[model samples]
Target: MSGFLPYGRQTIDASDVEAVVEALQSDYLTTGPTVARFEEAFAQFVGVRYAVAVANGTAALHTAYAALGIGPGDEVIVPAMTFAATANAACYLGAKPVFADVECDTLLLDHNVLDPLVTERTKAIVAVDYAGQPCAYPALRAFADRHGLALVADACHALGGSLNGRRVGSLADLSTFSLHPVKPMTTGEGGVITTDDPDLAERMRVFRNHGITTDHRQREQAGTWHYDMVGLGFNYRLSDLQCALGLSQLARLPVWVERRRELAARYIGLLAGLPDVRPLEVRPGVGHGWHLMVVRLIGACPPGFRDVVLAGLRARGIGANVHYKPVHLHAYYREHLGTHPGLVPVSEDAFARILTLPLFPAMGDDDVDRIVGALEEVLEDVR
Candidate 1:
């Protein structure tokens, strides 16, 4: 049998190895020149004026929230279908997370669903880029402008995605991305926040390093040790080593994103004829980065049909996985926020039927064929 096909993974070549090795050989490993270079390259790639590298995507969100002054009693509207990080970051700043419904097809925040959820306490709107496609940014911008709410994007799944000719990083006031192995790029474990606002960028830089005014390198160069804790923060800085890997990965991102799009098209075409499944749809004028090729099982899933299909696929060495369960469905949210079953009907429905297939840059046609074949077999058996 062939090896297990992961839902997603990183692709590292010799060039990536060389970049990490070179960083290891350098004098500064933790916070070095490489971090700055990576940040600059990312900013340029995303068409943003400033990018702040953080330890992880969650940190980027937390920093962004803090920079926006999101605090006690403030409310941030978050789509209920995304990773917990989307709402958790708001909670980190003692802000309340108001749940929003996503569109049934794309699993993205619905513009039509925003009004009922907005109130005077609404401080921001965090539009998630679900399954790598950019959210409705123009509508979101209008909504934010009308309410004077801070607009941010939890774009962890959309690194190279674009909306209406604008890269995701520049689409919101503060956009965040993840560099986990499964994401579009990997830095082992890292994240970045991109924005055109200089003050927000500077605040994030300080917040990532324990709210210090100057980094260690700056203090060392001045031949003095003078720094102050202007605000409460954490050690959320990305290491220079990881930044080196990220930089190398960033160089190949354009091609990788294109390949992902191609693979996604192939999946869509192959799955189009399947009556039991429906692939997530991409909107017009938006470029999907194809983070995860998710499909929903249609109709009555026959009790454990979903689980049985997942088990059958795994038995055949296919790592079919569930992209997510509704954020509010978790025990903590249920207990703390009084989150109940029908908070967002569409999201809850999706959580029950969604299944993510393997899709990555390194995958080949044979791999796609293998997954499709395995899924077909599983579906036939379950049905």
Candidate 2:
């Protein structure tokens, strides 16, 4: 039998280990030089002017929203199909997250639906790079500009992706990335926000360091023991150790993304002849980062058939999993936001059918074949 396959995993090597060890022996550990180095390198990679390191992806979102001055009575439009953290971050700052429906094919936020959701209270449009595919940024950008709303890219799933030669991080007013074990890269657990706006970057830097005017490094460099608290903030600082690993991992990202795309294409080709299963459509001009290799059951498949297929795959050690339940359908959102079953019909419909297959840089072609073989068996069993 083949070994168990996880939906995703980190691709660590000896170099990554050495980098962390070197940082451990360095003079500064937390939020120090290595963190700044990682931030700078990441900014260059994304073609952004500034990048601010943070504790996690959710912190990146919260800090970005806060930097945009999102506050009480403000509303931030979020795609209904993303991870809850996308919406939860806005709520953390006392701003409402208005859930928007996604396109049926890509599960990306549909720009067509934004017109009815916009209101005077809308402060920003947080577009998620769902499954590592870049959203239709041109359309979304035009809409945000017309409505006087700030555009934010929740690009945690799309770190290395590009659209028409423009990188994902440079596609919005502010862009966020997650360097989790399962993502395109790993810092163990870290996040970074990228932007061209200097003011926004500085705000995020201060916000991550307990809202203090200067961090320990700055104070020490100036040979002063003074610091000032400008506002309330969380200790959302990414450690130097994490950043060290991040630098090593970041160096490997381009190669890794290429590998991911190759694997995704292999899956697409292997599954092409399968009945009632189809991979999400990739939009033209998109250089998909392929964070998740998602497929949906179609036609004659029953409403709950996705869960059954997921169970079958897992039972066979395939490690298949669902990408998400729509944010509005989650119990917390249902109660708190008064969201109901049919609130976002397309999202709810997609949620019932979609499942994420295992895909990572370290995975081999045979692994892809094994997964597809298992899926084929699962479908055959149901029939």
Candidate 3:
């Protein structure tokens, strides 16, 4: 506990290390059996028919959008509160990302706010499960259906989360997940796309491998070197070494998510004493994966107060951070997309006050207490 605690981190055990070592010792480092095994296990875990592993989360989003046939002039609706990658992926495919406001309490994509953003050119809606609570998928799904638009879930923060009984990966037309070290599970640097449609799955598989009809493994199995590049794609393949680690880590996901929830509950109880600091609301029937322990500074706390709190906590070795600044507010989006302040007021307001406190599966209840205690002291000092 000597070092500064991070807001989120990977929790790897000896088994994870062993898995990677075994993968390294194997004949295939990439495009091999281990990758297929991880994909199958992940799909089954999330109640989806297919999962295609890729280089990373952004690649997953890019592949998902491409699979849905989103292209130039296509507009994709996405919440402003999410990571820039959510919107940037759409940009990668020459699709415009139309920013939608998030719900105040949850920082989740507000389906109600999406109506005004939809246009004739709207090709899809990307629902971001901000801070690991699944978005209002039922509403979003229904909305997408009415508009004949594809629904994609930017579920990088919500690998193990669910709404009702349906898992995050199974909640949309195509769901993308990050397997970054800080995510629910780690593959060092990797991502996967989940879908019930076989066609979409195949598209993503091809998309990750330079749009080639056959991979080296397939060519080797068939005893032929012939292949065809059907479409332009990126070399976004996830290696077998990472997949081996992911498979090991995926096995412990349920337990890790449970621990995260337990830590979140502990944070809630401890922060009750801090009247100005309020935890984000968890919607009913949602099983949050709690990738971030985000809280809002409500009551009399004004804009810039969150930064003060962040500074104070860092001085005390509590690694408090902010989840995001709204993507639309970023410089690139403002210049290119004509986005400006007041575009999504709710998200703008939340961005100013929200703070992400340390929360990881390896953290103890005492860690939650320490973080809350530090937050309390920071608030008191600011006053």
> Per-model C-alpha lDDT, please?
0.92, 0.93, 0.92
RMSD of 2: 1.0
Query: Candidate 1 — which pairs collide?
Result: none
| RMSD after CA superposition, every candidate | 1.1, 1.0, 0.9
- lDDT (10s digit) by residue, model 2, range 183-298: 99988889999999999998999899899989998899999999998988889999999999999999999999999999999999999989778999999999999999999898
lDDT of 1 by residue, 110-211 (tens): 989899899889999999999999999999999999989999999999999999888889999999999999999999899999999999999999999998
Residue pairs in collision within model 2: none
Q: What range of 10 consecutive residues in model 3 has the weakest lDDT sum?
A: 298-307
Clashes of each: 0, 0, 0
lDDT of 3 by residue, 1-383 (tens): 55799888999889999999999999999999999999999999999999999999999999999999999999999889999999999999899999999899999898887888889999999999999999999998899999999999999999889999898899999999999999999999999999999999999999999999889999999999899999999999999999999999999999999999999999998888889889999999999989999999986657677788899999999888888999999999999989999999999988888999999998988888788888888888997
What would the TM-score be for candidate 1 when compared with the true structure? Answer: 0.98
Runs in model 2 lying further than 4 Å from the true structure: none
Global lDDT of model 2:
0.93
Q: Considering lDDT, which of the candidate structures 1 and 3 is the better prediction for this target?
A: 3
Q: Estimate the lDDT of model 1.
A: 0.92
Query: After TM-score superposition, what is the CA distance of residue 194 in candidate 1 from its true location, in Å?
Result: 0.2
Instruction: Select the stronger candidate by TM-score from 1 and 3.
Output: 3
Model 2 / residue 40 / CA error / Å: 0.8
lDDT of 1 at 327: 91
